[model samples]
Target: MSETVPTPPSPTTRRQLLARTGAAGIGIAFSGALSELFTGTAAAGNLGHGGYGPLVPDPDGLLDLPKGFRYRVLSREGDPLRSGEGPVPSNHDGMAAFAGRHGRVHLVRNHENRATGRVPVPVIEGLTYDPEGKGGCTALTLDHRGSVLSERVAIAGTAVNCAGGPTPWDTWLTCEETEDKAGTNGYTKDHGFIFEVDGADPRRTGAVPLTAMGRFQHEAIAVDPKRGVVYETEDAFDRPFGLFYRFLPRKPLGGTGSLRAGGRLQAMRVPGVPDLSSIRETGARFDGIEWVDVPDPLAAGTPIRFQDFGPRGITHAQKLEGCYWGGRSVYFVSSYARSSEGSAGDHYGQIWRYDPDRRRLTLVIVFGPDTDVRLPGESPDNICLAPGGGLMVCEDGGGAQHVYGVTRRGEVYAVARNRQNVGTPEDPEWGEFAGVAFSPDGDTMYVNCYAPGTTFAVTGPWRG
Candidate 1:
């Protein structure tokens, strides 16, 4: 049931990463970002000294970052889009940056809304899936100076567009975090599916759901470029939790529309381990992983997690959130687990690395229950490899939200703080940070504030 996989001898080791990145810290190295974070470097400690120094308070009372760093509001909920269709939607969750033509960067952002929001995604013709569904994605084109050139509705009429992954061919997979079906909660069509959104060109981002990818409380996904296999995570926490999934696309990497051809949806299973939260120790590994086919990927009746998976049931995890591909392995996150919530175990947070080549899943980082709620070590959501090295984790826990950075030594440092107080002066409301990603060139960092729905472009001397 429990095993320790031998660490591969490579630059992935913590000692090697420290040597490469240097103990004092250098500039951001995009190539070794993920390797530095997972390799022994994610031991969970607040090294308040090394990361870009201390965060300087913002005069505008919006976002606080280190000295010399500044942020600009790129978009906000109710802001009018360039298409003249409607204003921006609310709850900007997961986002990805891509290279664009003529020295521009395209950003595909998810709007995590449901039936009602402050500003709903406009049900535009050709882009809307269901007229009743109000969650979708927006595409923004930024110039070299990180200025928004144009903004348009990429996909619309979806529900709970939570977090999704970017494709190898420069596309974004926007996922619906809800399992609402027709006649439920005013949904005109069945929800809970992945829709491909093209950041560069909104015309290509048809609001068609990839039904073959399984229908459940979809959270996030990571596509393996080598095998053309897509790794997905379910965030259902009602009773049975959620299962880790993989979608084998029939046409691999053909282009943006390749996944529409249909594929096989399967769930992961570990011989003896049923719930992933049961594993507590860091560096814990499970080998010989198995995949079981889901009889109903559409989940027209029973949800995927409750469905039978034979004698050996599928493995499930609590609050499986952020997912991304790094260093030939797929990294997924369990935001937090609590026994009172029906989880097998309890933890502040955990990051797991799954190696397809070795067929192994290792717990690289584990946040203890005693982790400071105000710190960056707990409730990590919407993670991405920072262009400046290490991992950029968005804190979704209690108190003031922040975008924290984990160095190559597993040391946690505050990268940016959410200073926006949405509530009154007495009881201030801080929104959780989401969609933390860097530009392809690594010059600018893009993140979102979930509550008021604001996107910020952060830039500074990242070569600390």
Candidate 2:
């Protein structure tokens, strides 16, 4: 199979696209009318203070942030929940915040637990999908002051609940990053699917997997509000990398439970680009992109990436992690790639923005191999567009872990650092940051520490 690489867009056309989309070169596009979020925000290069200034060491030795910022521990592993079911689960990963009644905050959090963990999501009657599966989601209700009012099990009986995305109709899509079958791992049913959780009403969240969305090593997803199309990422790091997918649902914007109706899953095909990691240029653009229908979304035997796509094979990327919908484009992350791992090239990370309107994919940001491991631009995992503009990226790399901020100009700065020492004082260990989100009013930020399984509500003077 072969594909012809199209010529790059002209400079004038690139400039016009950027101007029309308000894409600030950093892959930062105004999400709808969110341009006001960056009104007075300083450019990444011009910020002598480095975004919000230097991070001040925390007295609690947990999370360090800029001066004037404060964080509250909303929930932790083994912490008893208000629902009286059991303790909070471990390995907090992807999360989303929603508006709650009476100015409260509703958060749906994922517990990325596999077969075993420090604490597993307790199985409830209607919420339990498989009694043996040890991963699921939890819902928390917090007051406006960042105080946890209630916490309960949203869904249970799922495996490897990794990163997921929020829906347009106010629901959380929790994905299982596993392909374990029922009989292989002491299971009863097939795994590898996406489940919808209702943060507002836990009872309404029946633990049902959207099978039509495809079954593979699922990662994060981005939902296009205009068309109700779901763009998903797969984290399969084997010989052949995972393919980016988009599901065209039978019912668009049909609110909750609509996705369960079914959809057609398709893989992205970027002409001559077989491996995305080979494209190192920051502004490299690929036009005339196409989507190939997956032979089998269920993956009854062969995985989607391994499945045949005819003469032109599907394009794949290494470590396709975070995904989010911004303006008219869908931004997805490739955490890192290595030649030793069968990649075409090597790089610290790359962020690609796909414009559905133009059927174009642009490499907006590329973290070179020389990026400082201690810095913010290395191996970005879960990501969310900040309410105050720019982006909040969770680091999942070697050395120190931090929640970094990226401006429209592509400048990187530290927002919060994980200082919690889970190991001995002599050999300290830090957990990666995951599930970075913001409240509806944009006053509070919610993030999680994947290790000790801690959720934090951070408040401070956010840049407007």
Candidate 3:
């Protein structure tokens, strides 16, 4: 790639950017030892800290948490649980951390599958799903040392258990991002909705589905403390374009974690046409502050469609997937374009930010077809804020994808190349480590993915 990413007012070709070497200009310099290891396989099987701290559970060994943090293999892809009450499903998506009994921690992890009746033989009540993404979620409890105390099946019969956010009251807001029938969706009867998982006490109750979050193709979950509103992203751009929304619980949060009997769901609308100039024009900028009220969020033809960023809008939108809150901002990413529809503005990928203070949204990083000479345009998937700040984008796009980072000043660098050492263009698994998380202290990091389906931890001093 290019040595120094153009600061401004300069048109650079993709080739120049991909020509960058061992250590391109991303601020600090790489040591001689570190430089040689940058593009090699040795680092893949070892701890990689990139521009931050060390990665725990060295790739050479098994999954083990670093010193300060702990981990437990709650459930594996093909593992059976709960006396075979149900078969363990695959594709674990979103997860959250909460305070358990006497200071222990609890996690409500999601499984993304649309299969049904494919249960792994020998049924387990609260431990299995329809296997075909028929909508299911799980809960696991662990102590401070990373030892899993117990595991249980929360709720079954939900599809595409995509990513979700944690609520203020120590509960996970899991979302079913896909329609139940897959044919005719966008209604309450189907699978599109957000539910709550109470991790404190099992005696408190099992899984309780919350339908109040709406029935559109759900994605990430975010909460706005300023207004006691829970923000959500929609991957459902059937006709009018996907939407962003907020749910105001009708009853206080102490309710029975049921969406059907809860608050109101409202879609978001930017006040005035948001000025995306900060990204497009480079200089002809505006704060990008805009707001839209749902008005009648429950009505299918409600006025929520006004939120799309367009002359009203454009072709099918970039399906927004992951989202989280940090430093007073709610961040999210848009997946690539649909093949059915042609040139999606030839967009590689972009990350957008929403500021609660100014009540606006802005597109930040634009990783185009110049990411790497090995393979261009890798689909950027979910993302998490780094402990040292910035973002760790999980690249799911094809060939030679890496977990890359972007600074507020517009600098980008690869933290670790996810491609294994096997060496081959047809590498069956180039990048599967999609989900990334940090310990409470932000000193340790963990990552997991679908291919071969494994989780990793890396520990060390990564902050500048």
Give one digit per residue, the lDDT tens place, for model 2 in 122-235: 989999889999889999998867788889999999988888999988999999988888895787889999999999887786988899999999999999999999999999
Clashing pairs in 2: none
Candidate 3 per-residue lDDT, tens place, 1-464, comes to 00101121111123233333321322221111112112212222233333333334435433322244434344565665543455555666666666666656666666665543233123224423333335455666656666666665666656667778777666777777664543343223445667676655533544445656676677787776555567787765443446666677665455455344578665554443321211331122236443344544433443244433345442224466677776567766665444233322434455566677776665554555543334223346667766555566666654444566554443345555443432343323242445566655555455655443344445555552
Off by over 4 Å in 2: 1-49, 369-374
Once fitted onto the true fold, the runs of candidate 1 whose alpha carbons sit more than 4 angstroms away are 1-48, 369-374
TM-score rank order: 2, 1, 3
Clashing residue pair totals per candidate (backbone < 3 A)? 2, 0, 44
- Ranked by lDDT from best down, the candidates are 2, 1, 3
Q: How close is candidate 1 to the true structure, as a TM-score?
A: 0.89
How well does model 3 score by local distance difference test? 0.51
Give the C-alpha lDDT of model 2: 0.81
- C-alpha lDDT values of all predictions: 0.80, 0.81, 0.51
